[model samples]
Target: MALRITDECINCDVCEPQCPNTAISMGPEHYIIDPDRCTECVGHFDEPQCQVFCPVECIEVDPDHTEDRETLEAKFRRLAVS
Candidate 1:
């Protein structure tokens, strides 16, 4: 599933550059992830880099935009192709 940053985020900017899919972006309130672009690093890394780098542990699976691993991989593949 795609990951999202919560309001608890400290805005430390630690997770931004760590996202393999470049899905994380600065938001009006907190760092945000584009679900369409996020693959939880399935096609890029062994784990979610954002979650790893976030010192506040505010990154979590996006419940509102839940997706299976296969779907995430498909999205990754599509992004790679284009």
Candidate 2:
């Protein structure tokens, strides 16, 4: 599943750089994750790099944009090529 940054974010700015897909970006209030670009680091790492490096632990699975591992992997492949 894609991951999302919640309101609990402290804006420490650690999560943005960790996203391999460049899915995380500055939102109006805090950081936001684009579901289209998010693959939970499927092809890049065992776990989502953003989630792993997030100091506030505000990152979590996006229930509104659910996806399976295979789907994430496919997205990763597409992203890698482009």
Candidate 3:
């Protein structure tokens, strides 16, 4: 599943650079994750880098944009070639 930044985010700017797919971006109020570009780091790492580095633990799976591991891996591959 794709991850999302919650309102609990402190806007620390730590999670943005950690995303392998470059899915995290600064939104109007806080950081936001693009579900289209998010792959949960399946192809890049064993775990999600953003979540690992996030100090406040505000990143969580996006329930509304849920996806399986295989789908995330496919997305990662697509991102790699593009």
Task: Return the top candidate by lDDT.
Answer: 3
Judged by whole-model lDDT over C-alpha atoms, candidate 3 comes out at 0.93
- The TM-scores of all predictions, comma-separated, are 0.93, 0.96, 0.97
Ranked candidates, highest lDDT first: 3, 2, 1
Pairs in clash, predicted candidate 3: none
| Candidate 3 per-residue lDDT over residues 38-78, each given as its tens digit | 99989889999999999999999999999998899889889
**Compared with the true structure, what per-residue lDDT tens digits does model 2 show for residues 1-82?**
8889999998898988888999999999999999999999888888888888888899999899999888998999999999
**lDDT tens digits, residue span 10-60, model 1:** 889898898877888889988899998999999898899988878889999
lDDT value, residue 77 of candidate 3: 84
Q: Provide the clashing-pair count of each candidate structure.
A: 0, 0, 0
lDDT-best of 2 and 3: 3
Error of 3 at 17 (Å): 0.7
- Please report the candidate that would top TM-score against the real structure: 3
Superposition error at 74 for model 3 (Å): 0.7
> Model 1 misses residue 3 by how many Å?
0.8
User: Which candidate would rank higher by TM-score, 2 or 3?
Assistant: 3
- Is candidate 1 or 3 superior in TM-score? 3
